[model samples]
Each structure stands twice: as C-alpha cells, then as structure tokens.
Target: MRSLLLLILVAAIIGGIFFAIPYFRAHPLGQSTNPGATPTINTTATALPATGIGTIKAPDGESIGISDGTVAFATGGPGGSAKMQAADKLKAGDTVSAQSLWHSALTSDSGDAESLIYLEDQHVLNAHVTSNTPYVTIVVATMMTGDNASVGNDNLQGAYVAQKEFNNSSQLAGGTLVRLLVANSGNDKLYADTVAQQIVLLAKADPTFVGVMGWPFSSRAEVAINTLAKAHIPMVSQTASDDALTGASPYFFRVAPANKRQAVLGAKYAEQSLHAKTAVAFVDPSDPYSQSLERYFAQQFTADGNKILATEQYTVGQKGHAALPQLLQNAESKKPDIIYFSGYAADIGVLLSNLPTSGQFATLPILGGDALYELNYPSSARAGFKHLHFTAFAYPDEWDVQNLQSQKPKF
Candidate 1:
C-alpha cells in the first residue's frame, strides 16, 4: 500500500513538471526567439570588368555601364531578347571587337543561341560549344494550396537570391554569368499541368534550359515529371515531401524532406516518447495527406500492441466541433490515453477547440501531425490543451532562433 502511494505521487510529480514549466507554456508557433536583431548589410557593388571601349546591353535592352575586359549581353525573359541579337559568334579566347559581334545572334533559327562573355573576342568559346549552349534554366511550379505546397516558395526565393549573388561574383563561368527565369502558376488548380507545359515549351524554344527547380505539391510534381522525363530535365523541389516522387522518375529530385519521414518520426514520439497506448483518432477523410498519415499511424500503433479506441472522420471542410461532443463521449468510455488528430491546421483547430470538458482527453495528451504547427491556433485554446505535441521540420527562421535563444523576444 505504501509503495503504491509513492508510485502515484511520483506520477503526479512527473505530470506536473510536464505542464508547469514555462517552456511548456510557450507555443512553438509563437513569435521568434532570435538573439540578433539587426541584419548585416553587404554594401559591396559588383565591379564590371574593365573594357577598352563599347557599350553593354542586358537581354532586357538595359545598358549597364561598360568597363575594359568585361563582356555584356541580354538576360531575363524571352521577350528581353526580341529584335536584339549577339553581335558575333565570339569564343573563349576570341578578341573580336564589340561592333563585330553586335546583332550577331540571329543568323539562323537554330543559331539563336544563348549569349556568353568572351575572353579575347578572337575564337568562339569552346565552353559555349554545347552540343547545345552551356546554359540551364530552372522553373518553380507548385499548387496554390496547402502548407506543403507553399514551402517551395520559400526555397525558390532563397535560390533566386543566391543565384543573383553568384552571377555578380568574379567566379561566374568562363567570365560569363548565370541567369534565372521565374514564373508563378497563379494558384491555378490546373497550374500543375499548365506551368509544366510552359517549361517544356520554353525548353523547346531554347534547348539550353537543362534543369528545373520545383513543383510544390506532390500531385503537381507527378504531372510535371511526365514531360520532364522525356526532356531529360532534372528538377529539385523544396516541398512535396511525398515518397512516391523520389526515384519515381530519373529526373525528379527534391531538396526538402518528405512527409512520410516526418509522420514516422512523429508517430515514434507519440507512441514511445509520450507513452501513449490507447488513442482515438479524428481524421479528414477527403484529404490525401491526412488520410496517408492516419493510415500509417494506425499501422504503427497497432504494431506496438496498442489499439485505436475510436476513429471519427469528417470531410475536409466539414463542421468539426459539432461532431466532437458525441465522439468525445464515446472515446471517454474507451479511455484512450491520447487523441491523434490528422487534418489540416484550420480544421484541426476547430476540433481541438471543441473537445469535451469531461474525459481522458480533458487532461490526456493530444498529439498530431504537422497540422498543429500553424500560428493561428489561439494561445489560450492551446493552453487548455496542455498535453498537445506535434512535429515541425525546419528550425524556425534563423533570426528567430537567435532571438529566442537569447530570450530577447521580438515583440
């Protein structure tokens, strides 16, 4: 009897520590905790190569100041090169004067090649002798919806910034530079196919476009790969962490990790780390991402000798809290140790808000996939669900991490 009492006391203490800590009170989605507040400035401007004489016009017809030893040409969209052409077929060590090569790009339909910077203006550069030109174009394509899809935009922006810096540097290829072409699918549901078709068309117009950057959603990637495969174009994605995409096509690749890996990691934490044995699940029956996670969690939990006490599903945008009362009553009778929610943030927030006052979930752990990582879940509502836990992939923004670690909160 005395030993039983001590075990009970210890359990209470452990539970108390889990809830009472201030860190526990802080929501992961809350304002960034970055330490450094100010951004450092890079004030150095790109220095153009010194040229004896002649003017430099960018692909867009914008004249950049000329310098000795520097070569210039057009950049950006297809429209930028209209009417204007390279003055000559200059090569790597060629010393051809600017006037010699001016308007030299359009000698034939096949000869409308990408421009390059020359060393001597003497011979056509060997590097530009691509069975096609030595240039590659990348396109970022994504669906207009889902957190998973939006993640690609972040990576795309970062890549563009890096590309700009690279092009301006002295380390550019053969004294030439790189260029980028950016397009938005405009949140079009058909954008997956439309944007992909556009990319292929762009490549047809200029075979030098050797690579692509993205398709934010898995479905979009699936659709785009059909064309990308035949074209031999390799792609990298920031989102679409779907396993079905990898190795599915020789040309398909993604830099961002997939959701399957995330779900497995989250499930391990929910089952082993949180010690949840009996769980009740609320899934969104219509969404593939939610359904996939639910199925995996169910299989994993059952494998661990734990049973799902109950499962209740609603459509993607169905009224969630309205069904919660009856579900909670049923779940209480089964005494689940956890409630695993598999839905997007907007819907899950409603379900979480409506959990009944009486039952195991009133105080038990509430676990979820990436759905709970949203910033919109009310802090107070989350406070009510003290035992909530979820998985998040990347560390928050760099500056945010620094501020939070320093405890100098950014408003």
Candidate 2:
C-alpha cells in the first residue's frame, strides 16, 4: 500500500482530433476525485474477449495490444491506460492514424503480450510459455540520462514490479516463467540508434528473446522499430506520442494515445475548463511529436470557436528561455489568455521560470499536454508557475487494472 501510494504521487499520474475527418477516439481517464471536476472525452470501451487475453484479434491471425501505457494504484488497485485508441484507420489534416498492427511473429501474429497478463475474471495470470520455463525475454528500452531520466527510471521500476507480479501469478496459473531485459538508451539520439542496433543484435544472439516494452521517446522508438521490424520483434511504448507513428511500423505499438489526441484534450482543457478565448502556442517543428501537437491544438481550438493568436516556433536544442523573446513578443502583441506548449517539460520549465522576464502575460495560464506531467516541474520552475496546466492521462483504479490485464495480448 505504501509503495503503491508513492507510485501514484511519483509516477502514477499521468487524445484525439475532431470531426468528419474520422479520428481515433478512446475513453478518457476521468482523473479528478470530484465527479464534476473530472475532465471527460467521450470515447468507446469494449469488453475483454472470452479467451481472457490482452491480445485483440484482427481479420488475420495477427493479434495486438496497447503498451508503454500507464497504471496507478493510488485509488486502491491498479488502473492502466495506453496513449492511443485502436483504429483500423484514422485521417486528419495530412496525417493518417494507422490501424493497430496485428502481424504474426514466429508462431503468433499478434505482437501483444496477452498470454502474460493477469486476468481479473479468473483472478489469476494466464499464459503459454515454451517448455523451457522462463524462455522468452521482454526487454525495456528507456532514457537513462538527462532530465527525462527520472521518468524513465520510474517506468523501469514499474517493469521490475510487473516482472515479479506476473511471474508469481503465472506460477499459480500453471504457466511458464519469463525474464526481462532492461536497456538504457543513454538519452542521446545517436546513442539511441546504437542501442537499438545492439538490441536487435541481442535478440539475434538470444533465441529466447520475444518482445520489447519500450523506448519512451518517439524518435528513439522509431529507430528501434526499424530494426525490430526486420527481426519481427514487437515493442510497446508507454509515453511516445508521435502521431505519424500510427502506421509507421508494424513491429511498434504504443499503449498511450498519439500526440494529436492529447493535443485535442489540451485544447479542450484550455477552452472549456479554463474558459480561455485567445492563446499563443509554442511549438518545435523539428520534433515530430511536437509538430503534430501544434496542428492538433490549432485545429481543435479554432473549431471550438477560440483563437490561436500566433504560434512561435522553436528548435529542439534551444536551451533555456533564449528562444522565448519572440514568443513573448507574440504573447504581448496578442495579450493572449494562455500560452500553449507542445514540447518536453525541461525546455518548457525553463520558459516558465523565465516568464516573469517576458515582461507580459507572466501570470497567464500555461497550458500543455502530458509532457507537463514532468515530475520536476514544481521544483524546477518559479513558485508562481503552478499556472502550469496540461491534459494528462489518469491511471485506472484497481478494478480497471484487472479488466485491462484480462484483455492484453497473449502469445
């Protein structure tokens, strides 16, 4: 109970587009304890299959499940959420949200870990392991350095906890044992590529390797997916929110919704919850995740009858508030009600700390997406920067966790 409580405050906390464009939509986590205060995005939720596995079957023999998702036991029991809505196809602007991948790998077309999940209905874990007990390996790829490392570490802890819990439950269910592989990408783009290459090499070296759990950044996940695709190894990410990745690779899967969906949520939060009419957006064109979000926020906010005064673009490497003078200029000229950011928290934290220096709109509400869930925001930013508000996913309660586990993919 104590550890679970820590997970909630530390790592537990924590999408989609509008209209006839045909976008993917899933049930949003109503995080607030207050029923009325909870944010809602009306999406659909379907029941688990009778097979009692997380893997969803497609027209083909292929199976799939969302991963790199989230879980929180804060409200008693575990609740899990992936970052995406499963769809056969989704189209918005120039983007196409790809259908969930369900390709047969080795013996299983579904890359999901259904056989490995703990089922609520049965009250036990169900799985099919090779005769050689603990034969397959589920590797976790994450950032282990830089400001993002803390988030990655927390996620890694979850993996360890999951490994232990799954193993114990599997034993009771009369299933095979499984092992885990923890890989740190060093948080460098180039180094991440090297790590991805090494991961594939390791997979080749070990016949027992089966699937991967993640590489948190979309950029890194893409790099790893390129290689994993050839080897037919599957990976599920918890936080990589790149929208273009929807159809990018069959070997890659995300438990979280894409960035576009989160962008819509951000816009909704700003408009309906905050009652903001005009806003300035800070975007990074070089980052696919950030770029996709800029478009999503603009589209949804405008459609809702609100205005985005001006969008200030920034590069991925721009440290501190060095690049914000132009943004501040836009904020001043527009006198917007809020400033929207669609990038990582480290950079945004710098901007928030520098807001007073912007000389205008310093106290304006700062709205963002899940990136604002950065654990260090409060300590890293100025005292008044609590104005930081973002649209983040909430973990399911324990009841939801059982339902989610019962439905994840199986071998």
The digit string of per-residue lDDT tens for model 2 on 1-411 reads 222222232221110001101211121111112334311111113332232112232222222222211111111111111112211121121112221211111023121222122111012112332243433445566654444655555565555455555556663223544455445554344445444544555554555455666766777777666656654556667778888888887556666788888888888889888889998888888777778888999999999999988888876543535766556666668788888888777777767765663455656788887766656554647664667887765443543567776743321
**In angstroms, how far off is 182's CA in candidate 2?**
1.9
Measured by C-alpha RMSD in angstroms, how accurate is candidate 1? 20.8
- Regions of model 2 farther than 4 Å from truth: 1-135, 171-173, 317-321, 357-362, 378-382, 395-411
Name the top lDDT candidate.
2
- For model 1, how does the per-residue alpha-carbon lDDT over 1-411 read when each residue is reduced to its tens digit? 111122222222222322232332232211123423311112113322222122323233333322122323223324224313233222233344432443343232222122222221112223356432233334434321232323333433344334433344523344443344444443222334444544544554543344555664455577667655554455566545656676887557665566677777767887788888888887765555577778778888888788898888765543445665566567667788887877665566565666656654567777776545555455546654566687754434534666656743121
When summed lDDT is taken over every stretch of 10 residues in candidate 2, the lowest stretch is 12-21
- TM-scores of all candidate predictions against the true structure: 0.52, 0.62
Worst 10 residues of 1 by lDDT: 1-10
Global CA lDDT of candidate 2, please?
0.53
The Cα error of candidate 2 at residue 386, in Å, is 2.2
